[model samples]
Target: MSPKYDDVRNSLLGWLSTGLREEPSTAAIFHQLCHRLVDYGFCLSRSTLHLRVHHPQWLGTRIIWVRDQPHADEQTVAYDVEATDVFQRSPFHRVIHTGKQVRQRILIFGPHIFQIYEELREQGHTDYSAWPLDHSQGRRHLITFATDRSEGFYDDEIALISDILPLFSLVTEIRLKNQLARTLLQTYVGPHASEQILDGATTRGSGVTVSAAVMMCDLRNFTQMAARRPRDEVIAILNDYFDLIAEPIERHGGEILKFIGDGLLSVFPLDRPDACDRLMAAVTEAYDALARRSPLDHQIRFGTGVHVGEVMYGNVGSTRRLDFTVIGPAVNLASRLEGMTKTLQRPVLISGDFVKAANCASRTEYLGNHGIPGFDDLMEVYALRIDAELHAR
Candidate 1:
């Protein structure tokens, strides 16, 4: 390689090493790398990076960079993307599965070789090449480069890119691992709890007492539904039910701390002035959404109990396996109230404290004070008047 090419390679290596230490955004780093290569006189017209991420809703992510574009474009690959005909017929599949490089001179390949080559040829690209980006534990990703220049890439240019790939892979692995950690945390625990764990709140039994509106929701007849139905069908039903209930709660700023079988526990922190209002709106929206669903085999029914009080919120469990969740009488009360929904024949039951905090007395029907287990005095309970409009204040 000439001095100019050596200079370019060194500069890129320095940048990537800094990126590994700084942990910059993956998209920004990739976009900068592509532009730098172009500025160094490599005839690069387009480049793409494909990453297979460990996520619940997505299979992978694709970052596309076009020459002269100010920023790169990013798109998430869905879980079913691998099964699509387009992916099955593309060169990416070969590189990803075989852990090998693919080089195609677009002008020489017939249309039947690969659909991607045909597309590149139509876009005036003369050459296409894909390389397997290997990471730790035998995982493989993909990177591709295309050039519109008549001569395509020189032998030395390709050699330089090949030599620098290990450095690029090292930088990317660090970022991707961090991203995967966050994704797993957020998936298993709520975002707020995940942030707390990430911020070094992992000690067992460590917690804080905070005032908030808490809710417990359970699907009715779920045990019986699971008993008779096929396991796959039962799981599908549970997912659908959770989606319907979980979306509104998340949209209204409630954090779901746990999904216990067919039920979930959520909270709206009182730090926000509208916490109680948001809880009410979220429950109402969830109920209305579930009511609209018309399942073929059975009807969907659920019970919700809401209360406002102080609870211990943090990590708890054995020394080895700790769980970040809420505890104390307030959470217990919410659970008991949810159980009462079946006896009272009400879809939603609210404690008196929640009604006062939300200022929704006019919209609630007073159910006389009732004796609560583990408490001395009778507790006042109210049922939300479903006919009344409930929305965020």
Candidate 2:
């Protein structure tokens, strides 16, 4: 390598090492690297990088950098292992299967190997190169570079980039691992809880007391459904049932704390003055939303309890295991009310405090004072009547 190439080599290593110390979005890193490569006389006009990830919705992300653009663009695609016709004829797919580095000249008039080559030639790009890295786990990553210079990249330039390809792969793999951790965390737990866990609130008894509106929802007849249904059918039923309850809660800015068998606990934090109104509206919306999806035969049924008060929210468990959730008078009362739905045969029950805070007492019917287990006073409760057909269903 020439003496000028030495500086490029050092700079690439430095950038890759810096990734270990600080976390930046993958697009930002790729954009900076493209600029650096251009300054080093690599003559890059466009560059694209691809990494397949383990995710439910997305197959992977593609980061593209174009010269003169302010930043790189990242696009995600759904998982599709079956290669399409376009992919079958492309250099990227060939390189991955052959485990080789490909360098081709994009001729302006002569027959082009791929449609992209013809397009690049029309855009003044003279050379194209693709490098594919195949891992043992049947995953592959590819990086492609295009240059608009009169002459394609020289043999020495290609060798320089090839020598540093491993470093690029290492840095990219670390970023992907970080992305996977966040994706999985957010998938399994609510986003708020994921943030808490990532922020180091993992120890037992690390909790905070906060005032909020609490809701507990239980699927009616779920035990019967699970007992009589096949295993797969039972699992599917539970998933659909949870979605009916969870979708509206999250849509209205509530966070689900935990799922307890056929029941789920959710909360709307009281950080604003209108928090009560928002919570009450959200609970009502949840019922209507679920009812629309309910079967006419009344095969699926649920009951919800809404209350407002302070509760301890956070980690609680043994040293080896812990659960991040709410536990207090408010939470207990909400669960108890949910259980009452089976006795009273109502779809929803709300506390007097909720009615007062929401300024919606007129809209709710007085259900009289009710006694709760493990509580001294008889609590005043209210009920929101839904369509008779919905309740029967």
Candidate 3:
């Protein structure tokens, strides 16, 4: 091996660390790396640079980035989209087909792959090497290196990337999967979601304990709605309903605990008492939600209940099924009030305790004391008028 090779390799390593440290996105890092590699003669002169990224839900640690420099005309947006599609399926179909690590040389730039090559040329790259990369955090990514010169990545180049590929793939996969799963959770719980649930972050708000507000909401007749409607229609209606109701919860400082079947449990002041005001905002939101979404099959009505009191709150659950939850009387009362909405013939109901807790300005008509089945007292309740109070909700 040439002595110069080590210098070039070392240079590449040092240069690549900036990407690792700052993590300036895969594309920006690759563009810089490719330019430096070419300038140092690792790549042929005048070669273009093109790169792509793909992540799957199994590989953790590194991101997969694919690099190729095709003819100028070939690097269209459509071409890149196709490359991403290939990256997504390649791990399942091709890469993983050979085991945890797979490497091979193929004439991917031939006439059969001309459009791909053209895109590389359009971007100024002529050689192509499809290598998958991964990083810690469970994200599976792809690094495809392509250049304008004939012949693709050299043995040493391949060796360097090959050494890191497996670990990177594992990392990328894990990160990707975690992110995807988090996205799913947020979608289910609504925008006012917890970092403990979505980002896996946890820290105490303060050592001192404080009172908080908890709110609960449920579709009045989800079982009947699903039984009567097709699945697609149900999903469409649900999206609309959630969009209407969940936004206001998030607009204020509320954290959605979980989406329990058709019911949602959410808490305010989980982070602190600032969320107390959010309960009222949630009331306004729920009160007006049915109107805009009325077009998407208005037969479904929702019952929402809010209660304010003290509770211990934080991230708790099984390691595998960790949940950000509030487990105390307040949450239970909020849930029971939601159940009462059905008997009371009201869509939006709040405990007088919650209204006083929120210091709300809106009209809050009280419902006489009535006992809940489990807890002893008739929890005093108030129903927020739909059009009057929640325009800002």
Candidate 4:
């Protein structure tokens, strides 16, 4: 390599390390790299990066940078690993499968090579090159660059890119690992709990006491339904019911901690200013689970209980397996209220404490104080007014 090219390569490596650490986002890093490459006389027109991710809804993310654009555009596509006809003809696919760099003189390559080549040629791009980046855990990534130039890239420019590929790949891999951890955690646990786990709260018995609104709900006849139906059918029914319960709670900022059998437990902590409002909203949303109609004309019903009090929230379990959830009298009270729903002939019940905390006494009907097991005093309960909730909105 020439001395000038060597200097540019060293500078680019230094910039990659600093940019990866200082910048807060992947797009920012991409923006900086694209600018630096142009400054190094690469005559870049467009660049694209594809990364495989572990997610339920998405297969991977694509980052695209175009000349003269202030920032990169990003998109996520569903994971479909096998090659389709389009992929078979893509230069990117060729580089990934062959594990080698693929360079094309766009003007010389006809439409028979790939449809994309014809489009790029029409768009004034003269050269295209794709690099297969190998990351940890056997995951492979692809990055492609295009230049619209008279002579395309010279031999030294390609050699400089080859020399700097390892450093570029290292920075990208680090960012992707962090992203994977975030996406997986958020998918499994709720967002707030995921943040705690990522912040290093993993040990058993690591917990904090917090005042919050707690909710517990379960299908009214799930046990009987499961017994009557096939296992697969029962599972599908349960998922549908759980989704009806979960969507509203999540939308209103509550985190579902666990699902035990047919029942789900969720909490809305009193940390934010509007916690009570959101908790009330989530309570109403839980009622959606009861109101859902099945396409098969099968009857599905549920009951919900809401209460507010101090509870221990955090990790609890064996050393090998830990569950991050709430524990205390508040959780028990919520469960008891849900059980009382069947006996009281009510679809939803709210503890007096939650009513008072939420300032919703006018929206609830008093259901006479009743004694609960393991508690000394009679716990006052109230029924949530579904009609009042609808009218109020």
Q: Which of the numbered candidates is closest to the native, going by highest TM-score?
A: 1
**Which digits, one per residue and each the tens of the lDDT, describe model 4 over residues 1-393?**
898899999899888867467565665677788889998887999998887886788788889999998879999867675446777778877887888998888875446477888888888989988998888777888888889988898888889889888888888888878888898888777788889999999999998999988999888778778888999999998887788778888888888888889999999999867777797787676554444444354555777889989999899999899988899999999999988888887777899888888899987899999987778999899998874222111
Candidate 3 lDDT, 120-230, residue by residue in tens: 555555455554354444433345554444665577765665554454444334434545565566655544343444453554331223477887888767888889989
Query: Which should have the higher lDDT, number 2 or number 4?
Result: 4
RMSD to true structure for each model, in Å:
2.9, 3.3, 7.2, 3.3
Q: List candidate 1 stretches off by more than 4 Å.
A: 108-112, 295-297, 387-393
Worst 10 residues of 3 by lDDT: 50-59
**What RMSD value applies to candidate 1?**
2.9
Comparing 1 with 2 on TM-score, the higher-scoring candidate is 1
lDDT for residue 223 in candidate 2, whole number 0-100: 76
**Model 2 poorest ten-residue lDDT run:** 384-393
| lDDT of prediction 3 | 0.58
Q: Give the true-structure RMSD of model 2.
A: 3.3
Top model number, lDDT: 1
Question: lDDT rank, highest first?
Answer: 1, 4, 2, 3
Using TM-score as the measure, name the better of candidate 2 and candidate 4. Answer: 4
State in Å the error of residue 197, model 4: 2.2
Q: By the lDDT metric, which is better: model 1 or model 2?
A: 1
lDDT of 4: 0.83
